[model samples]
Target: MKIKQLGERALIQRIAGLLSGGSDIVVGAGDDDCAVLDTGGDDHLLVTTDMLHRKTDFPEQMTARQIGWMSVAVNLSDLASKGASPIGIVMAMGIPPDTEVEFIEEVVKGMDECASRYGTHIIGGDTDAHDELTIVGTALGKVKKGHLIRRSGARVGDLVCVTGHPGTAGAALFALDKKIPVSQDILKALFEPVPRIYEGMALAGTGSVTSMMDISDGLALSLHDMSMAGSVGFRIYESRLPVLPDVKRLLKKQELHEAAVFTGGDFELLFTVAPDKIEKARKACPLTVIGEAVEKGVFIERAGRVEELKARGYEHFRQQGQ
Candidate 1:
């Protein structure tokens, strides 16, 4: 069997279980991108690490600058989802000794772009020469006492809304996989992932949304994670899902709804709020009402039928063999 068959969570528990953590670690491994811990006083510190390799995370055709910039943007996307501001970044870069200095500079320049945009600084990290290129980043952010959004806050009868559309990134990936050169529109959506900094802040400022998370690992996985964490059920409307024209074409080609929701790496935000207060939230942020929270299990409304939802989003090193 292949690891992809096991889904994303099973794979996370499989590997994350092997690692150990310090006592002060409030949270480690699992759930919404990264783990969080209580920083001494009024702040909560978030730490997350993600890797980029040619075969797994990036394609060889991608430039050094695109690679480095995406690395920072993705992690910062995680931070933005939590409604936190970044403070520092530390990198663990693995490069072949033969790698050019000019290429490295491009990667750093990408990082710099995002860092300046979000007001975070890449403080320090380590380097190692490896057979393949690998870039890893661990970021630090401080969430104010009451503003940190977690997956566990969702409640039954809450309205499910998403920031931006759900399928652009997936559409972008599809284009890359088939070597389908993208149209100007698709290329921008796929390459430039906009972290929901403004949207998150607006949602956080409203003081109404019960729960929130970025749609990094696709909509299904993010929704599933929030449901499990909040111990509530979600009923997502398939027809109501905002899919880009490009993504719909991609889904039609695959003949699978899973292609739209199961594949990950789109860094939009998924969140829930009380149905009664949904109007207020709508006024506060630019989000689409995709679904709602339910009682027991995750459900999806497709065509006209409503059924339980069972699928995980993308992961590189989850399940290797069946």
Candidate 2:
């Protein structure tokens, strides 16, 4: 099969499968990112690495600073989902030797802005020469005892909620690709995503929230992960999903159902809270109740018919490339 047909995610899975691993791993080689042991006293460390290839992650017209900012933000966002505070960052950078020094400087500038904004420091990093540009970010975070929310703690009867709106980023991507006109506001929102640090901090000590994850790949797939990780089913009400107008304008062939249900890049938080604490959660922070956890299998209510929720989001090792 062609390389594109196999997709980058698939290629990674295939490569990952070919290797054998050792025992230093607390959590290894899967999920939104990876976590390794710190061996420090009384604290569980979270280590996540994200690599952004220039062509894959950003357009040619995008700014280097924004690219750096997003790279750090994406990793920090993962830490927030698990209720961790970022501590330090290390980077492995590769770029064509001919690349402008100013571009490289801007990237570092953006990374510094994001790091300082979140109070995380870039302690160490490396640079290498390559034919194409790539940035690999490794972030370390710490979570207090009993505060780290896993993908496996969701229980039946827990209410499922998400922070902020969905589908805007995906919509923006489609609009740009199709040469469709989108408002400047949406374009900016799409190019630059805000990680939900406030909502994440609020979830601390929230006894109601059982399981949590960031909606990185897509809400549908993220929800699917919670179901599998927690061993519970999910019942999502599509009617309750929040969507931006920019997304609605781009839904030409697919109905609103498809756009809101499967599109990714929203970067919001997907979490499960207990029924009793729903009101308390609302008072404490902003969220939308899109569904509840069930006993088995995923179900979605749409068009007045309740049917099984299919796998509609991107999968790393799926049949073929996107």
Best by lDDT: 2
**Over 4 Å off, model 1:** 1-8, 11-26, 249-256, 318-322
After TM-score superposition, the amount by which residue 202's alpha carbon in candidate 1 deviates from its true location, in angstroms, is 2.3
Give me candidate 1's TM-score against the actual structure.
0.88
User: Which segments of model 2 are wrong by more than 4 Å?
Assistant: 1-26, 31-42, 249-255, 315-322
Per-residue lDDT of model 1, residues 60-151, tens digit only: 65677778778888888888778778889988788899989898888888887877777888899889989988889888887876887877
TM-score of each: 0.88, 0.88
How accurate locally, in lDDT, is each candidate?
0.76, 0.77
